[model samples]
Target: MTWTCTECEFAANEDGQDACVACGSERPEEEQETAAEAAENGDDSAPEVVVIELPAKEKLGVKLMPPKDGVIDHGLAIDNINNPLLENKVQAGDLIVAIGGQNVDGMGFSGAIDLIRKMPRPLAISFEIDEVRRQEVVREKFQQNKDNDLDTQLTTYAVVFDNGPMGLNLEEAVRYGIDGAVVRALKGQAKTSGMISIGDIVYKVNETDVLCMPYLEVMNVLRNATAPKTLQFVPKEKLADVQRVNSRHSESFRLRESTSHVKQKLMNNPRLVKDDGNEGDDTQSIAQLIMDNKASPNVTAEYLLELRVDDRRMVMACTSESDKK
Candidate 1:
């Protein structure tokens, strides 16, 4: 006889199986009956199903990944930054088992996403309370804490500048509800000699952590600090791949930003096919090749020649402007 899951109403349970395949609920005892049978027999022993309604227009705010081999639960939460799931105490790496009171087992990645989009406003999301996943999350958090502790010990670069105008361009950024400043540009002495990078995050001013202070307050502190003020900076978080430097600061140009585009352009041309051996060394070797005006199998000499021509034109323009005076 087929058994219906009390939790998600999945009715495809096979005989001899101890759990509902669609919802993972345990099989009912032989003495008990399905919900319909129980109603006919006037039995109230079956568990009550609870449905949760979410706030209006609120989303689950998670990125889901496909399940691994033999995994039977719903999609996995891989990214949950500023997620509404956090408000409900749902964490990244948790298994999303249900949506809108329906079990999500057997649904592939595309099916799960489609269901989420079709779900009513203020979507109801449920997670599987698996002990194994819970323990794994605990261990991951422990490791993250350890990694953060190590990061705290790393040396933070300090930039010392005189009082007037600071000579450093600063911009505010917020992440995970923490406020911090980013180095946008370097001016005057800061541009010529400062060790602080354009993309680094302002960790501290003097001895105060910028993240602890309000964004406006941090700006005010930098604006009103005494002469010979110290600003400590650290690299931004790993996930923050933004490059702040613009064309004026080509000295700080990063190959990472254009790596894919450059590869695509090279790949589009049959004659400029990239060398397989140098694919992994693209960033390092490309920089050296551009500097030397040399071409590898993947890079064309015309590209290097164009760069040289641009440099020459810039030099000629500068010389002509000097002559005009």
Candidate 2:
């Protein structure tokens, strides 16, 4: 009879041969077939292997310096320690060893002082000094272990200019009953200049009063207000010329001049008088008027003031005494 070993595919005559010539297996054909089937089905395969890779170890030279017994002054600047580290030719990965009480003599290393104060010790300390390199290492370690699809929430707010006009048109400005002013007093005129160059207040809009509102809020109201608005505000002192120029071209020129002059006269009066149940006749002091009326306190007042001073300085520096007008 012919016999074939299924395990090794070895064939031989079964005439007195109990084992296959190639495999040396004495198993019967049926057993050999079963073993071969188990191998094919992976039932007899080797177990899966797992490998973990650790970060490469680099030797950092660390020496424990004896703690200084005396208290260090706490006021010692970080520059003192940082400068020393730089001077000693300490590389990024070098370790700094510090010893002393909670405070370094009173002034130990800033980093060490912080750590010791937070932790209870006989503090024996060992740490790498590679600030930049250590941070990179830590970041890389966490990044590798992080999951791919993580959800994160982010919130943002608009950057608002504190004192600038936030882009308002005439219609919107009028609809919100927005009021603003320009003042001549802010311009430092000796008399009514009539040129309303800067510093004016808008005391009211469409006869509605506004004295306590912030400048930006007033602008926002105007920019968002409905069309065809009337803005009424007080002019600063020494700005009669500017007021005339502004009023001349204005649609309500006649009414504005008459009302403004009346308001001015009323303001000049020492005794306050109520007109038509309105307190103080809708008039404001020159300083209050300028603060309330200017487009931007930062730009119109602050920036202009600084620029004027700088210009005067530059002129004084360049001009001879006769040239100064």
Candidate 3:
């Protein structure tokens, strides 16, 4: 039997233990009574926290916003394309309850960051996985795609690819948002087969639905599956409808609530503009001049295409001399 510490919220401590192992905080009196009552009533649905160990050497590759006013809240890390948190099966809005067994209940934004920075290698971080966030994200994506014409429904198709040179570019088959494995380009035998085409999203491999699986896990499933593999795919445009139907079938996948003010506040962050240094500033500044019969400026569309020799050379150099091709 185990009980959660109220001070640190560490739930892994044994019942006999007088204090929390993580933060060394004593168990709360209310928690002790609740645990006793739960045991007496045979309550088996007690909460269990999930924790993950991450090495300090690797960057988390995530953008985190500090909780305002030292309020400990969930969903500090924002999810975006290629975010490591998403790769680890964590949704956009998950809690960072503790770092290295220390609870971050009142830790200010800077304090949390400092703790994470100073923590030892392979730090244990407890996360309270929130499925509501996942549902909201998927539902938002589904709503965006609702504008697609549903009158002409596109159905999924299957193609069997033999062993050797399957012709699918496995590298580009990585997960992109909720679109699953998008078919970027098809060549060789895959192109020869009229059944599959570019822009088709992989729905399943060997009749197993991998739409929600991690990209690497999906890849492993493909690599380990038996040959003469039947690949199921749907037109890229119809993925949303399929997801909607799936959500309808399973309540867990369905959207439970709309986006909240807290989530919106967290999402509203300043964007960073990248600066490509002015290497050819002088040459690009020299624009070709054109004048009408009156000698006034005549900036026509054709005239805008024209540039001085040096400017043209600079532009070509900027494009790695690809303009000649």
Error of 1 at 75 (Å): 3.6
Output the worst ten-in-a-row residue range by lDDT, candidate 2. 148-157
* Better lDDT candidate (2, 3): 3
Give the candidate number with the greatest TM-score. 3
lDDT of 2: 0.36
Candidate 3 C-alpha lDDT tens digits along 49-137: 46656765854455565666666654244444354644765555556667777767766778878777877778766655556665787
Query: lDDT for each of the candidates?
Result: 0.55, 0.36, 0.59
Q: Model 3 segments beyond 4 Å from truth?
A: 6-48, 68-70, 74-88, 141-325
Report the alpha-carbon TM-score of model 3 versus the true structure: 0.33
Local accuracy of candidate 1 as per-residue lDDT tens digits, 23-139? 677877752445446667875443222223456776656666666753446444544436654555555556666666456776676777777777677665555434456568778
- Full candidate order by lDDT, most accurate first: 3, 1, 2
**Candidate 1 to truth, TM:** 0.32
Backbone clashes in model 1, listed as residue pairs: none
* Candidate order, TM-score descending: 3, 1, 2
Clashing pairs in 3: none
